[model samples]
Target: MKNIKIILGLVFLTISSIGFISCEGDDSGPATVDGPPVINRVTLAINDSTTTVGLRENMYRIYGENLATTKEIYFNDTKSYFNPTLVTNTTILVSIPKETPYFDASDELKVVTSEGVAVIDFPIEQPAPEIDSFSPVAAGAGEIVTIVGSIFEGLESVRFGETEAVIVSSTSTEIQVEVPEGIVQSYIFVETLGGVTQSEQAFGFKFVIYDDALKEGWWVGGWDGSEDFENTEQVKRGDFSIKRIYNGGYSGFQIGNGGAPLPISDYSAVKVSIYGEQNVGNLRFSINALNEQELGVILQVEEGQWNDFEISLDDPALIGENELEVFSQIVIQELSGNSNVIIYIDDLGLI
Candidate 1:
């Protein structure tokens, strides 16, 4: 009878010891265990399907043996937090931390217990950065530019053309950077740990009216026997610009046939770079082709140097009595002396 009683007491002690293995609310260190931890499978916390990769800030369930006394869990060497009560002898429910190491990862999920540690193959990462558009694409060096997109959380670098830009500020959706020097015309790229993303269009010209030739349904330009539109000698923004001489008698360079007016509501100014052959002067600059709708302003130029002009859309001279809804066309004529004038036009667009 005494032997039977001893056996009963031993059985009760063993059961109690097994129950105490969880150490409820006591996850400060590894628990006392009998065998090494074994990780069999990993799955999402909300379902039972197995998974090979885990996303940051997402909960996952690890199924294995000897996991009841789990003291630590790590994904890609990033320590993760697990609830003590949520751990069992066969499973551990934990969430991967947001600051997990994304690059150069070991791609392993490890579970540490009192006896030994077990690891399973796992890849953890975040979504790659994306680019929607950039504001004020036409900007000089040392100017602040903005890039709008999604998933810019882990910004590694931002480049304009091949030059690297200095990040002024950033958010999950937008990033502001200072334009680098020597960037004539190039695309914008934003890189992160996930991947690199390139912009949809080139960075410089937002709405290119003309680069090498007429664009965006421009039907007419340069009237009265002006030289060819494509000239490679005096190039500015792109491969070439319109560098030619016009007839002396009231001859002008006219752009557009008034088919579809330029949408200038979003832009603040009309930007263009011009260079003159000789010591040029103020010329007749009008917004339209017809005489009745002409609002002329004095367009100034210099000799032997390219000057980038930003004509304000709200200038009183550019908009006379008629309110300028959009920029329809432009007419530039040498009215200073009426002699044959040679000029070069390049990088025509809106700012």
Candidate 2:
């Protein structure tokens, strides 16, 4: 009887030892044995050693153990997005949530698994700024421009082309700044603690208009060849201006020095200011010699407000010797056949 009892005890001990061995050998066995997930390090997805704080809406990796079974992740209680297929037992790949609603980063990263939740102290950052649009899309230096976008909470710098601008005010959605000097037709750039962002569209430079030039050495004559227009104090910009009275039909005017041509070589475009009590349709202006080589743009002048017309001199064929003074004639034509139209013109010059 004693011998039989000893044999049974040995068998029971053998079974227990085999069970322990099996549990140790199988890595996918039970969650209790694996404890909880541990986050060793957080790094940019592109570089493992670059430990810069993660930016919102950007990708990053969390290296540690038992991350493959992670069910949820949070950056300071702000839930982040991750892919289960991308998670491995040793590392987890995730994208910081873009709409985190926080201006700054959080203090800790939380990871939850079926076994339990684990947290490691780390930083998650705010998203970079995004631009929707800006007002006065074209302006000269020292002019104030409004920039509309998201995440303008903390602005480090605003640049026009390569030149930095003077920031007047900033908010979550809008930024008001002075146009920087030496700015060309270049995109705007904004930077913050999160990162830098650039505008896809460029801001154009407004040409400097000479009001005095219009008062002297400039006359208007076209097919109608009438002198009904007069220089008036009602100016859109500077103190001097011209007012024209239209009495129906396709009428036009030629601007020159005593019926002679003027040179315009150093300028990029012609800027015109117009105001009328009624809408003017199909209005066009052209430079001398380039009329057939380059066509001007159509203008739809709204009533009761000042409107600007920018005609580009982009045609290389239009360039002439001593362009600043050689422009033979600048003619503005109204093809809409409107009757008794009163138009106010101001600030006509090279830009």
TM-scores for candidates 1 onward, in order: 0.58, 0.49
Q: List the residue pairs that clash in candidate 2.
A: 261-328, 262-326, 262-327, 263-323, 263-325, 263-326, 263-327, 264-323, 265-323, 265-324
Off by more than 4 A, model 1: 1-73, 76-115, 118-129, 132-145, 150-157, 162-166, 178-185, 191-197, 204-206, 221-225, 263-266, 289-297
Per-residue C-alpha lDDT of model 2 across residues 1-351, encoded as one tens digit per residue: 999999999999999999999977654544342768888888888766657466667788888887667899998688887888777777788888866555554577899987778787766665788999998877656779999999887789999878889999999889999986545357899898768999987776343333534535555566652433435545664455666656666677666655334334555566677776553666666666344554445667887787876566664434333244555567666768886566777766655
- Minimum summed lDDT over a 10-residue window in model 2 is located at 315-324
What overall lDDT goes with each candidate model?
A: 0.78, 0.70
Q: How does candidate 1 fare on TM-score? A: 0.58
lDDT of 1 by residue, 38-157 (tens): 999999888778998988888888988888878999999888888888887778889999888655689999999987899988988766787898888677667799999887877999
In every candidate, how many clashes are there? Answer: 0, 10
